[model samples]
Target: MVPLLKRFTVFNLAQCEGLDRLAPEPAPLPERQIIPAAEALIDATGADFRIGGERAFYAPGPDFIQVPPQPAFREQINYYRTCFHELAHWTGHRARLDRDLSGWRGGPAYAREELVAEMGSAFVCAAKGVVPTVRHADYLGSWLDVLREDNRAIFRAASQASKAADFLLAFEGAPEGQPAAARQSHSSVQERIAA
Candidate 1:
């Protein structure tokens, strides 16, 4: 009984920590949406997760997601679940996907974060070879509530999460929205940003 109780407590605390990682703040704008173009792997698998058109987010947890092995990750696939979860969060960083980590992340903020991460995970799982685990139904109610409360939450979170997903799929050497030819054009964009 003691061991079980301790495990339960630990799980709850860890979940709280995960939620805190994406603390919200007020911003000048609602943040920009990041979208990746379709690729061969995306086409072959028939699993392109469209944002703006619908909702999106990453699902964390081992479960054998498929991707080429690289220096960042030891093996071809990761067994640790939370790592993927965080990687999913990291994808929303300003430099990569430019996801808004600020103000009222749509309601509980935490709930919106979870929704995006879960959606991203599910899509990546299909690409990498992991099975989609059971998503919590309890959150569905909260998610809907948040969406209803904030119409833009669904759109922003989905857009940001999609870009994050594309950023994480860097091993494929594919820049989400950056076309091979557009790299030069974006050079000016980058310069403007730098200025």
Candidate 2:
């Protein structure tokens, strides 16, 4: 058995050996390339996107997404990240994945849905070759409460998130000159997601 506490030496990286041998971080993709890709994914969903608003949200009733203009974001990637998060919610529409979204804001059900969306966004971002970050750090406390109360909550959320990501990614690479909606049936994707 290992001791609960163990003494260890700590040293600054500047004084470490072979520090100069480390490789430089790869350059991030330009917004021009990344933004269009994200927009294309959004287009594939065929969901009405309304740009120009102080907040970003997906309206299940109207089956539409609304987000602030790109200029409102400090980084362009952040704008797409927000869009992806909202898109995850969009996938839960009754006609789509049919996830329960009746929870009021800040309620337990809402928090659970938020957790799924956050992970879904991260999955989509990773699939699109972008590193994902927590879109809503403010939800940490509620998320912890959710995980603590239910041992299997994380697993369920992760499974749901993977489904959401696959649903969105299925729209990618539609045949040339073919409408995205026509390229793949929503039912088929939903069945796969459910599986």
- lDDT of each structure? 0.45, 0.75
What's every prediction's RMSD, in angstroms?
17.3, 13.5
> Lowest lDDT 10-mer window, candidate 2?
132-141
User: Tens digits of per-residue lDDT for model 1 on 18-135?
Assistant: 5764666654433322113323334222222322211223322221224322222323133222234445554555544445445324446666776666556555655555432444
lDDT of 2: 0.75
- Candidate No. with top TM-score: 2
Candidate 1, after superposition: displacement of residue 170 in Å? 2.4
Best by lDDT: 2
